[model samples]
Target: MKFALNSNLRPLQMALLGSMTVVAVGFAGSAMAENRVTYKSAKAGTSYYQMGVELAQAMKEGTNGDVIVTLEESQGSVQNVMEAPSRKGNYVFTTPPSLVAAAENSKGAFEKKPDEKYKEIRALFPIPSLTMHFVTREDAGIKSFEDMAGKNILVGKGTFSANEGTKYLNLFGLDGKVNLANVELNNAVPALKNKQIDAFVTAGSFPSPNVIEAAASLPIHVLSMSDDQVKQTGAARAVIPANTYNGQTEEIVTTSLPVIAYTTTEMDDGTAYTLTKTFWEQRDKMAGNAPWWNGVTPEMLMNVSGKMHPGALKYYAEKGIEVPATAK
Candidate 1:
């Protein structure tokens, strides 16, 4: 048998051969690249989610598009802390330090039994301080936390907001005196308008969407906390900033807790180091998207109460930034 190829067929053969070569190269490049890590964040539009999107984009850019990251929506800080440590996969999460401490100690929100796996969790970075907002109707005449006595309030339905609200009530000796209306945040504004609830408490990044919406429709006031009480709760003093809401002229004095990014101890040093370095180097790019990402210095990221991921520590050390003794 003889095979004859016309001159016109030669070009087609070469083009097909070139296409195959390109596909082979592409596959080889994909195989050599690092696996994409899953980044867990809160619901869309929330500060956590916004920051997560920014960080993932920055990581992808810093890694020359080799280290891909995908975001998974979650139940925000409290639940994220409880589940992230035990979840299997190349994953990172955001949660408050108080919840991290709770998960480690197995008390407070976690009950008396601590989740031992939580001890394996390592700090990556602290995104921002989540300030507590106690919003009430201006007509309610609730001038302070103590004035919440005998008034119905919504602290969120089985959320971290509720947990913290209870803590605040107890701290101010208004626990039994205040009537907590077990209701979700979505119901807060309606309940307030109907005069069913006197106030609602939410803790998150400044200008909370729910609070803003409620303020637009009603006369709202954000209560302040005393410095001594903030210290007792281990919360940093923060301000809501003037004009965060309508009629909010003066900065509202409040307390805040740090929201941190974390990973499990099983994440290898090289990957962790690269991720930490990539995030740190690309932070300026992410700052414009979310107020929470602003001014996130390496020192703040390393100010965690417990030990940090060795990879993160290594990256900071390379930058000549000293890690805090408590976070070692």
Candidate 2:
């Protein structure tokens, strides 16, 4: 094939080819500009997972599809933080600030396999907190932490609630005095109804579905902690306002652990900025649909443990939000 004389095309043909090349390049650029982030949270059916879905939808709507968020089911906060070392490119996960601090220090869950990448993890924004709920049967006669001394309490295994509940009991001097039930949290309401356990502890955002379900089926009591008790736990204080659930008359003051969305240093500053801005801008809209979102506020940033992502920091600064010195 010796076709060497066609070195130059006609002016119109050359112009068309050049225009097509420009169009092709523009399409490529547009694709590159589209940021796709993977959002990992809790199990598929949990409240936290639902929040992830809502946040994904909000991100899409707020960014006009520029920033597309894909949701991934996570086992728990510990798993979320553990996977950070190997995850790549715009991966965001939710976890309590304490767990992030643990990962950074190579303590607790990360002690067995510490990763240097954990230090690179950065905070995005706070999400709804995990509020502790001490639910009891109305007839159980257990109203305060002290009254639970002789009760059978189910604090599900391998969760923040279980660990914190055990700690609180010990801190309150109950120790081996209480009969701690060894069972899953899913059986809590049924166990209580059957008189198998006097009370159970759960940790979630306020108006927890499990609490609502229990309250709806049977008369229940939500225990309130004293100011001194809350301070002793060294956790953030949260209040479940009265009438939040059926038969819930008085507000229950409780302890809370703040949860936050976090990303790694690998994410570009622009994408992080967009994600953070979109989250706050759409928060009210999300809250209108899911009450859990209502718990999130700018002030909760003080609870974030690690340094803020530079991109997220940029958005916060623009809004004049007060970021904690520890997270700055």
Report lDDT (CA) for all predictions. 0.80, 0.92
Once superposed on the true structure, which residue ranges of model 1 sit more than 4 Å away at CA?
1-26, 43-47, 62-64, 75-89, 98-119, 295-299
Query: Worst 10-residue stretch by lDDT in candidate 1?
Result: 1-10
List candidate 2 segments past 4 Å from native: 1-8
Clash pairs for candidate 1? 106-114
Residue 85 in candidate 2 has what lDDT?
90
List, residue by residue over 220-323, the lDDT tens digit for candidate 1: 89998888878767667777778878999988888776777888887788888888888878877776665556646665654476678998888888888877
Write down the TM-score for model 2. Answer: 0.94
Instruction: List TM-score per model, in order.
Output: 0.78, 0.94
lDDT of 2 by residue, 1-328 (tens): 2344354546667899999999999999999878999999999999899888999999999998898999999899899999999999999999998898999898987899899899999999888999999999999999888899888999999888999999999999899999999878999989999899999999999779999999987899999999999999998999888998998888899999899999999899999999999999999999999888887889999988989999999999998999988887
- State the local distance difference test value for candidate 2: 0.92
